[model samples]
Target: MERNAIILAAGKSDKFAPFTYEKPKGLFCVKGDVLIERQIEQLQEAGVMDIYVVVGYMKEKFFYLEQKYGVKLLVNNQFGKKGNLYSLYVARNYLKNTYICCADHYFPANPYLNDNPENLSYRACTYLSGKFREFAIDYSDAKVITGFNVGGRDGMAMVGHAYMNEGFSSVFRQFLENEINDFGVSDLFWEEFYAGHQRSLTFYMKEYQAGEIYEFENIDDLREFDSEFLMNVDSDIITNICNTLGCVPNDITDINAINAGLTNVSFSFQCGGEKYVYRHPGGTSGNLIDRTTELFAQEKAGKLGIDESVINMDLSGWKISHYIHNARNCNLEESDEQLETIMDYLHRIHSVDVASEKNVKVFDNVAEANKLMEMASMIKGNLKREFAVLIEKIDILYDAVRADAKRLGYGLVLCHNDVYEPNFIYDSEGKVYLVDWEYAGMNYAANDVGSIICRYDFADCQIERYFRAYIGHELTDDERRFYYAYIPISAYYFFCWGLYKGSIGENDGFFFLSSYRNMIRFIDVALESYGIVI
Candidate 1:
């Protein structure tokens, strides 16, 4: 008795668009091997001698399988018009004690389909499942499938592979024949016969632990399960990561997603009882961030006992850092004590030597706004006109601040140019730390203070209190004027930066518009307070 296998690859698989238009879903590859090809290789490894593939859309593409892998092809012309049961019905004559599966599904290990080639039929099920929108399985004490439904809350989900003996295959084929000929149910699914006609058929169950089975229903589904699937399509990144860690890929126990920023992706994984965080900078981050500058700033901050420790970095800006356990973002509204602690860290950071070559000047927004102006000039629409008007208002604010800065002569310090509430982290021991120093550079101390105050929407008294805490003395009339002057300047900085990001398509349109609105609002407040009219 020869071990036989059947692969169902007839459906159009329209859910996976444009790519499916070129070839059938089975030809899609995971890791390196094509989906159906991997299945065929595994079947062959399990001693399957006779292999059959039901091909429909792009049937000619599968013809090479006959020569390459000794696969027999059964073409279903109505594959585009009917469901999978119709495809199975076309191959009813070949139904016997054989292993059956879909071509698009992948199994991590050989399922050993020929293990028990006796006349017993069984379906493979997985205990680890999430958000399964299709079918679910329910099994009884004898390991027999008792019930199946769509919205099943249990863990058992089909792995899209089953072993069927002659008795089960004959009954299934007869039911499919009746549906197609007597009931004219051309769109019926083969699983529906097992699920609906449960009283007549008993499918013995074989359960696999999670992560063993992966079914790529569509491109989106494929991406969600493995976001890094395409990054290391040939598994090169995993190999590189293994080399870097001096461990096998399997030794790294878990990889969990970390929601950090809009442009980049981060994940936390554990290996050898130690956890680490890995961040892959997104493509657009290169447009908005200078990784060299960031690396330098973070190193300097780490030396000053401020930032997280960088364990390792790859050439492609993939960073592996020591994970900070039990840490949460600081809430400024927590108390005055927390505010004082954060202020102390900021002052120390300002006291450190700045390695960044960039500077924040009062007239910096003028140059930034000009960049926006130059970009807006090329557009041939009303958008250009609106941006032109915004530039006019920006010019007035820039001139006002430049004149004040020249008169007051504010001092410069190493500043975290992008200060926000979320950047401050508080650990379990009440130690406050700062993260994300991409925009750190030598800038006016007032710019950091004003940026923080404005971002937190601080009241005038709160602003004065914060300044007093940092300065450790009363602000003279000139110093007060200098501090107030940077409020609108910092707002314009964010506004111009946001516009710059939008011009280069670095972020979404809503973020760009919000930045413009903030710039205008701060300009108005500064003009009204400083008695400068634009």
Candidate 2:
């Protein structure tokens, strides 16, 4: 007999707020496709033409889904008061010779049912973890005779889309008839009925790993599941999913060719008279969404302080942020005043009480320098041997200098961990905007000044003058020593970061190598200034 599939999607999913606040759990997407869409596709793949969705929460949203996907919708009126069994009972009329499944549980499409009825009757089960106290199973002959406290256990064979012969309705009806005076169906009904029937069977499925059955019980789980799914989704599938979200671009425009340090491809585009940057962090970083949101918040707060316009934010599975014009770069030699302005801007950003409230932690420079030493040790060939040795010397210098700074008790101040030229923006009004707040946090402020001096070709006098202005005092002998000391430390960090990027095929090794060479030159000059051997 041909089979039909019924999906139960009625729960309120209170645990997944903000994420599930506006949409039902069935509409949750992995990669680009919604769970309901995946479920439908799986059913279609299984050769089931007639599909029924039992929906209660956000039922109207599925109306279009039913029409678009050609599936029938069954409303569960008592969904709020009762549970899954009650929803099943309401849809019982459609259950004759049907396959029942839960809307939230994801499984691969496997159409071939066991031909042996005895074997087909089996239930999937597993031992529960200690923390998952709600899970229980009553079993016999590889089939579940009863189940209870089903939360947090993969123990109960998912029954939403279980195959049922014509006689299955009689069994289901009998189970419902014996329901306790309590309004909801008890967990014992299925066990009692299956045990009463001599033909029932059960089977334990393979344990779910990376690709299987990621049950979403909380927002964190949902985010993690989406990130993993996005990483594995095929390109064509991503296109379809983007189309479903109503944000797919008609034609690629201004590809930027610059990665925003995300997993997926992103580009700036104009849609509906509004300009925005559409980012597809396909799978590279799991925290891309959170990072994007934080950036938006920081930008808003920063703009307010400077009397600049607020940037509009539209975050999603794909990140979309405000598109800003590229600012002019100030000439390091001709624009000494501009350089000082930039330093003052940096000082203002560092002075702002942003990092402390956010609880941001800057990466340890000493630890980073040590990592370079380790990476140098791992190099195997003569061709890169000089570069490795150079890194080792730089690491040693950084360690000695950082130890001195700590001993002197130079108070930690907010520092921009990366103070490279590209990260500085000169607005048309000649105001300097320090962008890319990724590494902003509390640290030795000289580290920030040191990073800029090492990376950019600024005049030594201008550099000293800018530092003096920023800290509101002429540099003491110890302060100058500390700043010069951290120059190699910053260089060691950049070199290591570049190596790490290269190891991961990110194409940034050459930039780091250039910076490393510059640091060596700075080290010689600093030693001469300190009256130490060059």
Best prediction by TM-score = 1
| lDDT for each residue of candidate 2 in 1-534, tens digit (9 for 90 to 100) | 577777788877766433343467777766667777887887777677798888887888789876788998889776666656766676777866666667776655343333234424333334444445333554545443444344554454333234565566566656665663344344333433344443533323322233344456664565555645433333442353345345543332232333434134444545455555544443324421245433543464365352132343233444445545665666645766866766676666556554335544545775755554455445522324556556555555655566667788865555567676665656656666555544555667778777776665456686676577556688777777777777776776676666555544455533576567667767655555545552
For each candidate, what TM-score against the reference?
A: 0.58, 0.45
Model 1: per-residue Cα lDDT at residue 125: 84
Per-prediction CA RMSD (Å):
11.1, 19.0
Error of 2 at 358 (Å): 7.8
How far in Å is the alpha carbon of 274 misplaced in model 2?
A: 3.1
| lDDT by residue for model 1 (1-534), tens | 665888999876756543453467788766767889999999999888688899988889899999999989999888866778777888888889888889988888887754764557988887644566656888899889988876455478777688888888888777776667645377767787567678877798887777777877665577677564445344444555566778765565456667536456676778788888777776456644556656666776777777755666654566777778898888766567777776777778777654444533222435544554455445423443666655565566667666776776744566676666677877778777777766665666777776666554555677788778667789986667666656666665565555555555455333344445455556666665567665
In terms of lDDT, which candidate is strongest? Answer: 1
- Lowest lDDT 10-mer window, candidate 1? 356-365
Q: Scored by CA lDDT, what does every candidate get?
A: 0.69, 0.57
CA error at residue 517 for candidate 2, angstroms: 1.7
